[model samples]
Target: MAMNFFDQFDIPYILGTPLVIPALLFPVLMCLTTNRFLKNRHMTIQSWLLNKTTKQLLEPINTIGHKWASMFLTLFLMLILLNTLGLLPYTFTPTTQLSMNMAFAIPAWLMTILVGLRNQPTSSLGHLLPEGTPTPLIPMLVLIETVSLLIRPIALGVRLTANLTAGHLLMQLISTAVLTIMSSMTTTAMMALITLMLLTGLEMAVALIQAYVFVLLLTLYLQENI
Candidate 1:
């Protein structure tokens, strides 16, 4: 029963090995391989989306960090694909797993910190204590800020994992209830079914928004450093 309820978040295995690599690669492999003068509707829509999203995401970023734009865009694409694809029947949502989210969060967070330290050591370290901090309160404030700084990656991973997991669990519970009561309470089952449909739509939007938020937060962190 436990397995049945949470199995959607589990990493699937093909024979012996986990299937995460292939799942992650799927979005990357789906992108256009070559540029052509002529484009189909699918290609045209894809290009338009790419351009619009890139502009929107990069507008807040500074010129120095523009080089990382491709990396950020690729990560966002992977996240959105994984999230939305998992909504389909018989699929797993990787972001629902804390470990996977942490894996992405830690490295990205660490990279931004490293950039700040390398580019402007004094300014980066200066963030530990705000200007005009009272003498006695300085230590306490610094301690608080340090802890907060260290918690950023944890917050990022937990935010993604918690949001996705909560949505999936709610959907599962609603569907289960709908199934359980369908034979006896037809009207109630219909209501539950409608709610489930609405919730699914909301989850789709959450998936996209979370992907954007993840990349946007990373960009914000980079902006602080650059």
Candidate 2:
């Protein structure tokens, strides 16, 4: 039963092929791409919000980092949409998959590291060690720093996966309890149902927050590189 519950987290497949790609791209398709000067109010408002968010995120970043603003902004929108939409009934969340999250994390993290290495090799390498360090601790500190650096993408993937997975599991457990006790104990079932509703709302907030945190961290990584 527990394994089956967790099996929901697995990527959906159709005829033995993964169906996650289309589900992942669903939000992008929902975005309007008309070239007309005039647009609907919803799309216009969304565009304005997107502009504002991009400005806010890029403001603290360096001018060189501004070049990547569009990419990051798109990523933010993608993540927010995915996270929120996953809560809808019968929808699959690609972000729930570690492989999917790792795919996003590794390349972005790699890009920042590569950019840092290509543009500012000395300064980038300097990040691994601090100044005025004692000679005895140099090797140990460098080793620890290297390990920390290597763990970042893994951290990113795991953080996202763990949060979403926990929320989903909690929701499932509460829902199962509600269903099981619905016939025998009306009072207990009602209370569990109320808690489930509250948790559902909380999960929605977590969804939005996790998305923002993911993008924010990515931008910070970019800031370090640029």
Candidate 3:
């Protein structure tokens, strides 16, 4: 019962053996390149989508920051895969975990900060204080700005974790309800089953949107620095 309740969020194991790393890497590894060209229709479609998304994401970023294009695209694909795969039966979604989200968030956030500081120290520090501030409110505004700046990664991680967690929890509750009432309340259960199916479709869209948003935010951060 406990396993059924918490299985969506918890790290899943097979035969009592943990497989966290492999689960996380499976999506990424699936996209690994081969020497031969990808000639299949689906592979070609994927490549086309990748190309289009790359252009859209990099459009906002400056040429100087364009070097991170591959990283951004790969992260986007990995995230989408992870989120989508987790919707399947008896699978784990690492992005649903706050710790895992933070692991990705913090480093990416820090890299942008470091880039800003390294390439343009004055401009980076200048972000803490806006121009033409009144004397009395200077310290207060600076503190507020600094706190906001520092909280980006936390916001990023929590946003991803909360969104995924809520969606999965809702799906689980609806699914369980459907099962519990199916035998006794056939019509009502059928309605619920329809709702669940619709919600599943919505969740799949959310999965893709969240992945794009994550990487897009990262690009925006990098845009500020570069």
lDDT of each: 0.90, 0.86, 0.88
Better of 1 and 2 by lDDT: 1
Q: State the local distance difference test value for candidate 3.
A: 0.88
Put down candidate 3 lDDT per residue, 1-226, tens digits, no spaces.
Answer: 7467676677867888876788787875776653237588777887799889999999999999989998898888888888888888867888898898899899999999999999998988898999999999999999999999999999999989888888988889998999999999999999999999999999999999999999999999998887
Q: For residues 1-226, could you state the per-residue lDDT of candidate 1 as single tens digits?
A: 7669887678999899787777777786777654567689977998899989988888888999999989999889989998887798977777888998999999999999999999998999899999998999999999999999999999999999999998999899999999999999999999999999999999999999999999999999888888
As for candidate 3, its clashing pairs are none
After superposing candidate 1 on the true structure, give the runs of residues whose Cα lies further than 4 Å from its correct spot.
1-4, 32-38
User: Candidate 1 clashing pairs?
Assistant: none
Models ranked on lDDT: 1, 3, 2
The segments of candidate 2 whose C-alpha lies over 4 angstroms from its true place after superposition are 15-17, 32-36
TM-score of each candidate structure, all chains considered together = 0.93, 0.93, 0.94
For candidate 2, the TM-score is 0.93
Error of 1 at 92 (Å): 0.8
lDDT of 2: 0.86
For lDDT, the strongest prediction is 1
Worst 10 residues of 1 by lDDT: 28-37
